[model samples]
Structures are given as C-alpha cells and as structure tokens.
Target: MRIEKHPILTFERGKEIYFIFDGKRIKAFEGETIAAALHADGIIKYNTSPKLHRPRGLFCAVGHCSSCLMTVNGVPNTRICVTRAKEGMIVHSQNPRGDLND
Candidate 1:
C-alpha cells in the first residue's frame, strides 16, 4: 500500500508506466525508482545474500547500499532503489552477488 498522506512529507507522482520484472509486467510511475515501484506492486525480494543466499530487499533508498541491486536492461548490479522506472524497461532479480559481465 502506498503512503498517500504524511504529517511531514508530500508525494508528487508522475505519469503511469509499466516495466517488465522477471518477465512480469509491473505498473509504475515515471518518477518513481524501480525498487519503489516493485515494492508498491508487492514485490519485496530484490536479490539474495552473496554467501548465505538469503533474500534481500530495499535497504537504502538513496543509492548508498547494495541490498537493492538487480539487473536492469541486461546491466547487472543496478541499484534499483535510485534508478528511475521507465516504460518497457526489463528488470531481473540477481543471482547472489550478481554478474558484472551479464
């Protein structure tokens, strides 16, 4: 569920758009980050831990952490938390630490 109202913040959204996540179409807005859109669409698992292979999700929304890394349009290790969601963009969940040569 989106936070429509807050005591100290305001939200301004852009036009509606759609992106591919793991071969599934996800609804999003132009200005929202991929992680935000995924979260809004009820997708919480972004990746997995490198060693333990545990599920990972959004940790830092400001692009300062690796917890939100994923593959976007064939580019691996993309920080979806800071990358803006675009129409028809392809996103995929990474495998463990992610592959840079992908």
Candidate 2:
C-alpha cells in the first residue's frame, strides 16, 4: 500500500523486511523510515506527551517536533520521522511517562 505510482517520486519498491511492533509482525521497505512505513500501515499514534500524556503523531514530518517520537530497539526518545526503517527492527509505543526502556 504505497504511493508506488506517484507523480513526483519514482516508484522503486525496495526489499521487504520484517519487524515487530508490540509483538505484532509488520513488513517495511528496506530504505524507508520507520515512521513512514508505520503511517502507511495506518499507525497514527506514535507516542504520548510526558506531562499531559496527550496523543501525538507526525506533526512536522521532518523531525522538527518531538511529536513523532517512539521507542526503537530499546532506545528511548527516538525520532521516527528521521529514523530509517531497518530489517528486524523493534519498534514500540512510548509510555505515558515518556519512557521506552521501561
């Protein structure tokens, strides 16, 4: 479910790779960012705010805002928008306290 036939960017589907999110199996392109792939899969809620715990998603789509932050492979405070998706990567939703290692 990609914009394969987009007008601007040439559609060059990359190699498929498997990754896990909250114990769920998900497939992503080799060179795409984790956020992009997740968004493509209809995953909008990335993390919650630290204090208010409000839901946050892709705001800037350029890593400017911390709204798209999530946990990746046990690393906390990872900016999914800028982070590229990799094979066998593990991504998880951040906790309400803004903690991922927990």
Candidate 3:
C-alpha cells in the first residue's frame, strides 16, 4: 500500500519500480524517499536502538537524526529519511547490531 494522497505535499506520481526487502518484492514510486515508501507500506520500524534494541521510526523528516536509518541496496548506515528512492532500489531494516542482511 502507498500514499495515494498527501495532505501538505502534492505527490508527484512517478514511474513504478520493484525492489527486494527481506526477500520480498516491493514497489516504490520514482523520486520518493525510501522512508516514505516504507511508511506508506505500513513499515515504521526502520532500525533498532543499538543499546536497548528498541524499534525506531522516522523522527525528523530531514536527515538530522539517526532514527530513520536503513540499508539501501546493500549499503549500510544509510539515512532513508533524506535519501530519495529510485527505481529498483532495495531497502532493508537495520537490526540492533546494525546488520542489514540479518
């Protein structure tokens, strides 16, 4: 599921693309952020806390905080909140140990 309509920002519909997450294929709109796409898909837990292992979501829409960190296309320490989603881009949640392919 994706955000069909947004309140503030007008969603510019873009080309469809497929990406793999946890071995499952998912669709994302072109030029959308990975965090936005995931959030639209009902995925809030982007990463776990390093110490307490508490699930973390998007705190700041910008890339100031480390809350919305995820692995993008096998790259670790990716800030999904700011990173724009592209066609065929893969996004994975980071574990407590900062592992993406766990």
Best by lDDT: 1
Q: Looking at candidate 3, what is the lDDT of residue 64?
A: 95
How much lDDT does candidate 3 score? 0.77
Mind giving the per-residue lDDT tens digits that candidate 1 earns over 1-102? 789999999888899999999999999988999988999989998777888989889997999988988889889889999999999999999886556673
Q: Once superposed on the true structure, which residue ranges of model 2 sit more than 4 Å away at CA?
A: 98-102
Candidate 3 is scored at a TM of 0.79
Residue 29 error for model 2, in Å?
A: 0.5
Shift in Å, residue 43, candidate 2: 0.7
Which residue window of length 10 is worst by lDDT in model 1?
93-102
Clash pairs (backbone) in predicted model 1? none
Indicate whether candidate 1 or candidate 2 has the larger lDDT: 1
| Candidate 2 global CA lDDT score | 0.81
Better of 2 and 3 by lDDT: 2
> For every model shown, what is its TM-score relative to the native structure?
0.88, 0.86, 0.79
Task: Provide backbone clash counts, one per model.
Answer: 0, 0, 0
List model 3 lDDT by residue over 1-102, tens digit each: 755678898767788876766566667778777777777778777677888988788999889988887778888888988888876677777775555455
